[model samples]
Target: MSNPAARPWRETKEGIALDVRLTPRGGRDALDGVETLADGRAVLKARVRAAPTEGEANTALIRLLAQEFGLPRSQVTLASGATARLKTIALSGNAAAIATMLETRLGAGRQTG
Candidate 1:
């Protein structure tokens, strides 16, 4: 069966590439859910309390994702969109495990409109 996590992430040779829509300077750090863009692309909605300046928001996002995926900070990196709300995150680990984890996590709260 195709992975349900494929909506927000795709398996890569190194690990997985995740698409995220980040909300910087949010009240707290959390993954709101999965959202489908107008272009038919799915993205994870993440929020961090840190401001956008000085890469703090990006740092917070990495930390939050690391915690969520049970990985070290170094395992999660911002692959693109340093200045935009849409971002690509590179996570290094077992692709299957990460995809499973993402599927399980996303299953609880997926929003499409």
Candidate 2:
């Protein structure tokens, strides 16, 4: 399997509005979406699967973010849109650091929620 990294996405001051393609339960957690790069370039793609449920998908998202950023689950939080398909996740520490982590650790795999 390829490392869940390398894919790139741009970061913003108000946190990232990820173009996520969520796979509700029985899916996989990988970076799958189109996002502008930090350098203002248009790069697209990454995939993550963790069914949209009552905090289930959010939990999985936290885990994935932690794994990618090498941070603890407590560090990541769903800043907004928990019930909606499009959600906003806030990464503690540094936004740029988290963005780098996502760019590096985004690929196909099974991530439990």
Candidate 3:
């Protein structure tokens, strides 16, 4: 069985590659299950309260990620997933160090590449 706290998602391409399990209209926007990428990327899983409509979810996602990483909202960008549960987010600056922090804090495994 998979560890409940173990994140299967990862970070790549100087960005975060996630296997998102979206729950639209959730109680609140949040980020969790941060991990490391071997290519020096920061990976994390997120949850948002906005519905998946008119880019609402996307906006919420960026806001949540920015808040989680303590970066500006513009620092987080949706690389894909205009209308999908799973999405890729690109993060900028000190990515490797951030990934290390996520891995240590969230207890998620790291990506080799």
Q: How many residue pairs clash in each candidate?
A: 0, 19, 0
lDDT of 1 by residue, 1-113 (tens): 44354378988899999999999988999988888888878899999999999999999999999998788998899999999999999999999998888777776246755
Candidate 2 C-alpha lDDT tens digits along 1-113: 33333233335575443434244463676554444445543333333566566677768766875675577777667776668655556566666666655555553232222
| Candidate 3 structure quality by residue, lDDT tens digits, 9-65 | 355756544444445687888655544445444445567889899999888888876
TM-score of each: 0.90, 0.55, 0.66
By TM-score, rank the candidates, best first.
1, 3, 2
Q: Between candidates 1 and 3, which one is better according to TM-score?
A: 1
Better of 1 and 2 by lDDT: 1
Residue runs of model 3 more than 4 Å from their true location after superposition: 1-19, 32-45, 109-113
Q: Which stretches of candidate 2 lie over 4 Å from their true place?
A: 1-21, 33-50, 102-113
Model 1: worst 10 consecutive residues (lDDT sum) = 1-10
Cα-based lDDT for every prediction: 0.87, 0.53, 0.62
Candidate achieving the largest TM-score: 1
lDDT against true structure, model 1: 0.87
Regions more than 4 Å wrong, model 1: 1-6
RMSD of each: 2.0, 7.7, 7.1
Superior by lDDT: candidate 1 or candidate 3: 1
lDDT of 3: 0.62
